[model samples]
Target: MFSVWKISLLFMASLALTAATIPGKKDRRPLGGWTDVNVTENDSGLQKALEVAIREHNKASNDQFINVVTNVIRARRQIVAGMKYSLNVQIAKTDCRKSDSTPENCTESELSRLSQHKRCRFVVYLVPWLKKEELKQNNCD
Candidate 1:
């Protein structure tokens, strides 16, 4: 009986050790991991990220008119030194330019042979406390 009890205790100890080493559902959010954020969640933060992307896009674009996000397709986030936002969005060309009176209510270009709403993916890194955002990458089609 003493030997049997000793064996059961050893087995339990091994099981406990294995549990810690094995990855589980709870381990999904490990350090430096990216998390899929709902497009509707964190409205202000998402908006800021979108703005950064749009500003950068306009800066690099040769298109005559400015582009604006028409829809948010998806969003992801990673916690780095500050935070990183990954966005997949649909953008439409607008009639407003840099000197336009107001961008609001600007007509959007139609999705036709010559022009179409673009699907864009942008990755932005931001340090919130500093209120600064850098566009790490942008791709659109």
Candidate 2:
């Protein structure tokens, strides 16, 4: 029969192995890295709004998808253009709530640890594109 200490050591080793096998949270990202899209010819307001929406969305959730709603609203209707734009943003899933908030106070090592969990998510909608034709529509094929 194995001694008491010998059995205890074996049990501990088995426990460690089991823990190691458990999967940890994955680092999620958009299909491609950060993408830059032209918001409009010279519409800074629309750009700011889009950035704000993305930041807020990240705060609500760290998932790898964004929900953009295209409905006619007062503010959205003002930005009339011959073309439309789309932006799919993704933020890291870390304990750090805000992108700016993390860089200021969190250390490299600390940030590395909190990146192993899942969180809530939300979406927003803006519509100013349905009226526009395709990019090459005006040009002959």
Best-matching candidate per lDDT: 1
Alpha-carbon error at 23 in model 2, in Å?
Answer: 57
**Tens-digit per-residue lDDT, 37-139, candidate 2:** 3444456644544444544553454444332222212223122233233433323343444534533343333433434332222222334355322211110
Best by TM-score: 1
lDDT minimum window of 10 residues, candidate 2: 132-141
Q: Residue 43 CA error for candidate 1 (Å)? A: 2.5
**How many collisions between residues are there in candidate 2?**
2
Candidate 2 wrongly placed segments (more than 4 Å): 1-36, 39-47, 62-78, 81-85, 97-141
CA lDDT of every candidate = 0.81, 0.39
> What is the Å distance of residue 48 in model 1 from its true position?
0.6
Across 1-141, the per-residue lDDT of candidate 1 in tens digits comes to 569889999999999999888888876687888888878766777788888898888888887677788889999889999889999999887657656623344445432334568899999999989988899999998
Residue 59, candidate 1: alpha-carbon lDDT: 80
Worst 10 residues of 1 by lDDT: 104-113
Q: For each candidate in turn, give its C-alpha RMSD to the true structure in angstroms.
A: 5.8, 22.6
Give the CA lDDT, 0 to 100, for residue 53 in model 2. Answer: 51
